[model samples]
Target: MTSGPECPLLFLDVDGPLIPFGSSSGHPQDSASDTWTSADQGNPLLTRLDPELGPRLIALGCQLVWATTWMEEANEVVSPRIGLPRLPVVEWPASSTAEGPRGLHWKTRAIVEWADDRPFIWVDDEISAIDRLWVDASHPGPSLLHRVDPGKGITDADFSAFDDWLRLVIPR
Candidate 1:
């Protein structure tokens, strides 16, 4: 598989983007999918996943990587439920060191480092102004830091934004 500078990387977070969690039980009407597999029985939250999202994400044509705390487990559990194949997982740095700026999320630095000059899109609910500013200052390639609503997960609007940015940044 061609990685490195050839393809744009999409760093996906599981807690919010994949599994929609709200005060009540329901998910976004449009984003919900009926696809469910036997593998999802282990985790109750897994039921919230819209299985069809896997195909949509694959259609984006970016190299998908797991950026969630779930780590390798993302491949083990989430992938099967969503109909995605095993994806690369980001190896987080040891947390014993100092934390950065006040608003900066812990994963921002690692995400940028993993990209290593390759263009990337980071989809997570925790992104803030501080993360954006840091990536702009530190990363050398085009980047899009998109924040999904934890309560709603990914919506049509988010996919549209991703598609629009990708069209401009990478050619088919």
Candidate 2:
């Protein structure tokens, strides 16, 4: 919420970006309770996150907003699953979808108003061109939308791309 005005923002996510696409399950309280993520490889979601990426990236000085379908489940489910601290979550809008909307991931509209004016990175699996255009046109400097490929875990290749973005594009 506070990420809009002057500070840089990182709208983080869980199910798709952090835990790998389709790698997470429903809330523990939900009737469709399932444990996401394969026990084999853990999760390659945050190769260069706050604690792991070290302070250099943290010195980028950005606020991380958990912009995912995880919603409240971010606390009940994702926190323990990924070993991340209790990060703030952005609630998806109350819209409708035909096939795969309500059950697991909800389409997020709140991100528009919540993004504010800060530089932001939207890391999600469901991001579309329309979403990218919306944020690119409206938000502040260094705003970007990164699509993490499903099934394939976040590899070094992905971080390499991010590094380019930070260095060449943003260059902060």
Candidate 3:
């Protein structure tokens, strides 16, 4: 994932951030059921993705990158469903063994490396204090590790926060 100097990078996670894991009604509040039939798809969770989010995310003017276990499949399976283009996907390092400080997410180091000192935001459900501390100390540029609720995914409040941060960091 090469740095785009013009816009801050937004490392997006798919499972919990895009597809809310569990809801009180047992389905996402903004479920894509009307647009997509989950019966045919191998992964039912994909149905939880709201198509409206794509335009909202694009409106933020950040360079969005996939940072999920979904990998390239995020492009093949999730992109069209959410009206997103084929953005760059972060490739996770092999060897599942944890390499960084305890409580640091496996994707944290790779994501920071991908940013390469550029200002960036990581939107995921699993971001932890340790990950935040590590990034604060190691990453030279500005960064925001915004953790989403797995049960609710991203809400209007999250978008508002993103808009607020992007305005300060990129300045239009």
**In order, what is each prediction's RMSD in angstroms?**
3.8, 8.7, 3.3
Model 3 over residues 34-145: C-alpha lDDT tens digits? Answer: 6544432666667677878999988888899999998987887788888899999998989656588888899999999999978999999999999999999999999999
Deviation in Å, model 2, residue 91 alpha carbon: 1.9
Between 1 and 2, whose TM-score is larger? 1
TM-score-better candidate, 2 vs 3: 3
Evaluate residue 166 in candidate 3 and report its C-alpha lDDT on the 0 to 100 scale. 80
Whole-model lDDT per candidate: 0.85, 0.54, 0.85
TM-score for each predicted model, relative to the true structure? 0.87, 0.61, 0.88
- The TM-score between candidate 2 and the true structure equals 0.61
* Model 1 accuracy (lDDT, Cα): 0.85
Tens digit of per-residue lDDT, candidate 1, span 79-171: 976789999999998882447777788899999999999999999998999999999999999999999999988889999999998998887
The all-Cα superposition gives candidate 3 an RMSD in Å to the true structure of 3.3
- What would you estimate as the lDDT of candidate 2? 0.54
lDDT of 3 at 156: 93
Clashes of each: 0, 3, 0
Model 1 regions more than 4 Å off: 1-4, 23-42, 96-99
